[model samples]
Target: LGIGGVRLLRALGLNPQVFHMNEGHSAFLGLERVRELVAEGYAFPVALELARAGALFTTHTPVPAGHDAFPLDLVERYLGGFWEKMGTDREGFLALGLEEKPWGKVFSMSNLALRTSAQAGGVSRLHGEVSREMFHHLWPELLREEVPIGHITNGVHTWTFLHPRLRRHYAEVFGPDWLRHPEDPATWRVEGLGEEFWRIHRDLRAELVREVRSRLYEQRRRNGESPSRLRQAERVLDPEALTIGFARRFATYKRAVLLFKDPERLLRILQGPYPVQFVFAGKAHPKDEPGKAYLQELVAKIKEFGLEDRMVVLEDYDMYLARVLVHGSDVWLNTPRRPMEASGTSGMKAALNGVLNLSVLDGWWAEAYNGKNGFAIGDERVYENEEAQDVADAQALYDVLEGEVLPLFYAKGPEGYSSGWLSMVHESLRTVGPRFSAARMVREYLALYQKGQEWAGKARGEQEVLRAFHQALPAFYGLALRVEVPGDLTLNGEPLRARAYLEGEVPKVLRPFLEVQLVVCRA
Candidate 1:
């Protein structure tokens, strides 16, 4: 994919000054660029430096084990001849990605991208810090704070995720150009439109209920269930109930079964005075047995509790189902283990449509939660073990559901709608709409691209400086260096001063290339 992507660009007469690699999956494009430069008469080292200067890498995986690696022999078998063409031996090429793993020494794609990119970033602020620590060994001379990895928090395309009815409503309230300036919070502040907003939301919820019922009925028919069972599927979820949506890849860290920790307590909440139902839709990776087990457990628990009518898991989750859930649900639920979730964007999509998020204080929510806009599962405290963390977070989820979320949702005004809930919906729209829009994300990336172009230009100019220095080597042979230090260099409360100067004539362009350093040591 990586090699073909680069060649395709060249074939189309498109020359991009900077290449932004979304993940290690595309790290091979860097090697292809180096090969192209080598074929154009540049030495391997110079080509590598040029490629590194122009490339930018963004790593989305926070866990070390999540990275892609291959056995040494497998890499040698496929890329053996490719490396030789770059004027490097097999060992030298393998050293670019060589790392020690529990299994054995392997070639890591992430390590290659990091080594071949001038700029690297993560998908969120916390992720950036996590990545710095994860790859700190690569820059042993620098502190963790000085690591070059930065973050550009992921965002969603607002219009694509926003419900069509709500989009037209906004177009009428604000001008048609409202979407053009989605990064501005003022664009979402629709004063005195509370009742209309609630009406549109209710209509969307009804639409979602119809879609869910149709899907459930079709699924039951495929399973060869009785005609009576298929008829019962049409009445699964309540349209008027407080619906909570949980949809994502059923990874274990996401804790898809967290709500089922205490079946009785969950039952009480589901059968409480206020109506509440859950709609779950996701698919586990085919190879992940644990993830598949979680999915099976969710279905089994729904049957065991005899709450099939209140809780429904939609099969074959896709973009169409995701849009329905995000647009029609009263609340969006995300319960991933803290710090393990690398900037989830589904919650952003839901929040863009005024669906209040109930999530752990991780990923973008860690930074977006302002105490009033949404509900947080727990404080930012990770326990010593996963089991303890799950217990605490699950308890917190129940507490928020019973103590805060339920009350605010059921607190209706004289006009027959929850005014407090509307306030939170407004807050979510005002905050998330501007900050988490694709416009802002793209703007941040454009800034990074500009910086990458500057780095590449500087690298090319440095090569020019090297050539000039070689041509003027005879004149530079007589150059001398002189240093001056303050006479009162002491341990007072002020910084000591020092200066260095070239004691011979130097070319105008070469003056900026000279650098000086001062080293301090403990006696």
Candidate 2:
């Protein structure tokens, strides 16, 4: 009866010490816990006091514009019954799940989460400082740096997702111990996989290339391009030749069009003496035509350079294609504008299969990179005009390829084979490749999200109900909602006329509404 939301948690077989919310996503659970205790014969004041004892929250944004707010009436509609049943007044109800203060006149999820959660955080160290200044209103008494938005830098789950063959190849490179002792990825260094593992990796890469070639032919046939022509073209592809792959979701921020900045520079890089080729495989969201258009422009360039057989665009890409391209490529190209990328995962996969990175300094690459480990493309200065940055970075990329990478590929010996590129390949595999992975990231998430083993969200069930209020899975609650928007209660806020669209559904299969305090609800 005294335990606030811990009662619900205990009911579920999880014993709780605290609660944790990912974002504004779970703020209402705080209020729900308080109300549960209040309903179970505890005074509302005592329940409210106990509610703040053990909780944590995290936010991911740094600017005020990123926060969300809703009309006050929206909160009233959902939680009105919960507060009324708990005998709490309207002012008290408005203050339960969130709060907004006088100075800034903002309703902040970061604020609610920080003030309510016993511990709170931002996703990175730099972001945590930015967030402290951004959400200083939540803790009016504390200095910005002292405000408890702890930093837990983001990570990925690289191995859980490694194609089994890729994982095996990694085990051979780093030894079985690398998986257990990932924190020090240099463990692979002492064991030293040397040159033999690279050979097996290269052969596995050939197998993946064949699979991707088959897929490309399949897609070309569907596009009304000749299936027989595409099939015949597959035979001409250079599986033994160095193949570069560029595959990621084609968001504009990624600078997917960077390679086309200089026609002459690209002409030199692509049509090399070593006959290096590219396989571009990625998809823009249906709404994102800028990236899709960039890809189409690239298609035209293959014809322009007269490297049609050498360079190809594999479309209609999915997870399966992503796996193949990562494993098959000699190098994975990621040219996102510097510092904008927030922990790219494709590069990690490439590292696993001994495919080196040709990427700008951004996201995980910024952390994992040694110039010798793979290829680094740009400087860290944030440019005001993106067009200027694109031009500069693209030129740098062109220079690196033409001067360094291509020369290495073409450099021959008495044996009539180039071996210079192999040094960089070995460096990538030994250094940045093994360390930047998802297992390390997942361990970081578990530590930061769990809050020193304080949260029991994995346990607890349902919070207390005053009179055993029941609902169904398809939640057959008998209620009527009819509103004439502009004629009904006006939304009297800034710009004064936010649009109201009325929607109706008969017998919907879920609970109808959610009420949280002081701001908007997008859920």
Candidate 3:
């Protein structure tokens, strides 16, 4: 369908260039290209093989459940004629997991991805490793060591996350040179400037918080939300209070319950003289009714626990609110199970604005965290049993807050505001902030794209540039699968004939694989 859609879009005269296949949903673009070539009278073999170099495929799914697939009947109905045209006998198509998929009933999107693309990758280093092993069945030519799946860890856009004025303040103080040489000698020099600089950073954070709070309140009023609660939220807004923001899709894996793990501890922090507060927001997919209910339950907890003054679960979150939460929060809290998260751009947003992370040892945090900068929810929960992990993680979060976070926020140096908070802010920037921005990510991509293009060639580049793609393979191998019949030769127990791709002529030894096309199948 996507292949058809891409073809339609091109026919509409939009001159679109470069199709980024977010996932397998757009794999049909490859099919579309093949269709285009065929329409122009080029053979299927030339089109499919030639189109490989230009396209780039990035796989977001590390798990089998993540890929899309369709039943054999369904495939035949849509592209069955196309497959027949390409000479894909049952065994050859099945060899590529186009049939009899144990992962799913239908051909997997990941399977299609590995087989179809010249260049393919996972979203992060760990994911890349997982993906390589997962697809080892297909690339028997390459050992696990030789597999070609690459990695491009996700990153947040720095300019999008950091406050423009605060960023400019840093820019002004350090000069535009700071962007190029974030780790430069002069950049580190700014750390030594005592109290005055810390005051400026904190003041900027406070003002940004005000802007976000006003925006949220106004939006709520426009939506006809309770005016009294909106006013109450306004009154509760304290630029000076230790604010924590927890916002993301309400997946059960994110462990949203970590906040209530130790009811007494959390209540103490909220009830304390300084008054810590958390602003929560996120959406569950419309189909994930359970996850949506979990979010609603969290809202009920706010009322049940009388956390109305301290906790607010804003409903119907979107990109606009995301900006406010990441920019305004003193700390960004994320507690998903280990490795489930591929990469979290939200934490990166929080990092650039000097918001510390209180997160699990997963996602981008796995690479960026140091114990000194902020807190990781657990030490070995990343490697623990489910029950043990939950208990340990719950405790780990409490320890960081009660033992570390509270003291640092409220601590006053003998010399005052310059001492404690200033130290944490400076350390977080040096350790977490600079290392995770998009500028660093883009440089990694440029290198990857260049190398892939060289191997893929000019035709590959054109597809990537133009978003046009191949519809089918030109001379790809196809294998025949059949069951045995006693005293009779059978192809998968059906009347047997097979086809295989060979360099020149079909051979008997490879009859298990046939180069001859199956012109028909008997019932």
Candidate 4:
């Protein structure tokens, strides 16, 4: 996959200066790049160095099991002829990924990528720290903080997750270029549109209810259930009810069953004065027995407590259902074991559509939550044991639902919408919209790519003179100029008049180098 991807790029008449490996799965690209340089008459070591200088690797998982590793014999069997092209012996090639585990030595793909990349990072700030400690052995002499691993938190594409109605509303208020400036907080100052916003959200929620009912009915028919059971599926949830959504990979550490820790308390909330319902949709790995067991336990509890109407587990969770849930749900629920979640992006998607997040203080939530936007399950405290942590988090979850989330949601006004709840929706949009957008993420990555290019140029001895010139410049260098428009210009093909004023001292020789022009943008 790695070699084919690089070759495909070359076939398109493109030669990228920077190679970004999303995870260790693509580490083989580094070897393929080195081989290209070798074929061009460069020595193996020099080729490897040049390839490494322009490569960036981003590690996504904090758990060891999540990373890919293979037996030494397996690697040799598959890559036997490949290493000959790079002018490296079998032992030398294997040493790039060699790691001594308790069972035996294995070839870790993550290790290979780390060895071959010039820059490496984790997906979030907390993940970065955890990664440094996890891989500290690779740089034993350096302090944990001094380890070279940086962080660029994951983000979701705003338009992909945003509801079309909301998108239109934003375009109407903030203009068509609103998405172009999604990272700017000023672009999301949603106010006085509370009634319309609630109406759009409720409409989406109604559509979601229809979709869920249809899916549930079909599922019962496939299982050969009774007509009465199929009919009950249609009436499973209330469209007016406050809905909480949970959807992601049902990994054990994600603690999907944490909400069921105290079934009696949960039942009370479900049967309380205000209506509430939960919509769960996710799939566990086929090999993960424990995760499957958690799913089974959740289904069993829904039947055992006879709360199927108030709670549901949607089958076949796909991107379509994900969009429905994120767009329609009132709250996004996440309960991962502390520090186990590297950086989850599901909540970010939900938040983009104004769904409040009720999550444990882990992953992206650890940095995004500001008390007003969403509710936290528990404080950022990790217990010594798993049992204790689970118990505390479950209780905290119930407390917040009963004490805060429920009351605010049900507190409606003359406009037939909860003003307080809409305030939170506004805050969630204003805060999460800008900071956790793919637009911002791509910009941050571009900066890293530029740095990688500079490093790669240095490795090839092409940037020494440029580096010295940059270093020789004064701290207070370059021009500080502002443009002023004295009069309003009509759009009747009239040329606009503007003046440029330089605010800082400049050398006489540099005067001719400065030129200013007026740039106009059509709205």
Indicate which candidate wins on TM-score.
Answer: 1
In order of listing, the candidates' clash counts read 0, 9, 22, 0
The TM-score-based order of candidates, best leading, equals: 1, 4, 3, 2
**lDDT on C-alpha atoms for all candidate structures:** 0.88, 0.64, 0.67, 0.87
Runs in model 2 deviating more than 4 A are 1-11, 15-20, 23-28, 34-115, 121-147, 156-158, 161-178, 227-236, 287-307, 409-435, 449-523
**Greater-TM-score candidate between 1 and 3:** 1
Return the clash pairs for model 2, or none.
9-460, 14-459, 55-118, 69-520, 70-519, 70-520, 156-438, 157-438, 158-438
Per-model TM-score on C-alpha atoms = 0.89, 0.70, 0.76, 0.85
User: How well does candidate 3 score on lDDT at residue 160?
Assistant: 66
Q: Which runs of model 4 end up more than 4 angstroms from their true locations?
A: 462-523
- TM-score, predicted candidate 2 vs. hidden true structure: 0.70
CA lDDT of 223 in candidate 2?
Answer: 74
Per residue, candidate 2 scores C-alpha lDDT tens digits across 1-523 of 2233455677788755566676654666666666666777655654554455566666665556445554456756655676765557876665543545454333345454555555677655555666677777666767676777776655445566556765675677568666776556575563355455556656766876687678767777777787577766576467777778899888777876688888787877666665677888888888878877877777887778777677777877888888788877877899987545645678877776667788887766776677777887877666889899999899888877777776776685654434566666667656654455555555765775465344333212322321222223233334343433254353446332334322444333233543212324444
lDDT per residue for candidate 1 within 1-523, as digits (tens), equals: 3878999999999988899887666988888888888797766677777888899999999999999999999988888798877756787788778888877999999998988898999999889988999999788867787788999999999889989898988888777889998988878865645888889988888999999999999999999999998999999888888999999999999999999988888988888888899999999999999999999999999999998898999999999999999999999999999899989999999987779999999999999999999999999997879999998998999999999898889898887789889888888888898999999999999998998899888877787664465566667657887878878456858787888887889876666766666765556
Which of candidates 1 and 2 reaches a greater TM-score? 1
Error of 2 at 87 (Å): 8.8
- Candidate 4 lDDT, 1-523, residue by residue in tens: 3888899999999899899997756998988998898797766677777888899999999888888999999998988888889877888788888888999999999998998898999988888988998888888867787788998998899888999999997787778888888888888877745777788999999988998999999988999999999999999999999999999988889988898899899889888898999999999999999999989988998889998898889889999999999999999999999889999999999998889999999988999999999999999998989999999999999999999999999899988888999999888888999999998899999999999999887877843443343343452266577778777667677776778877776654444544555545578
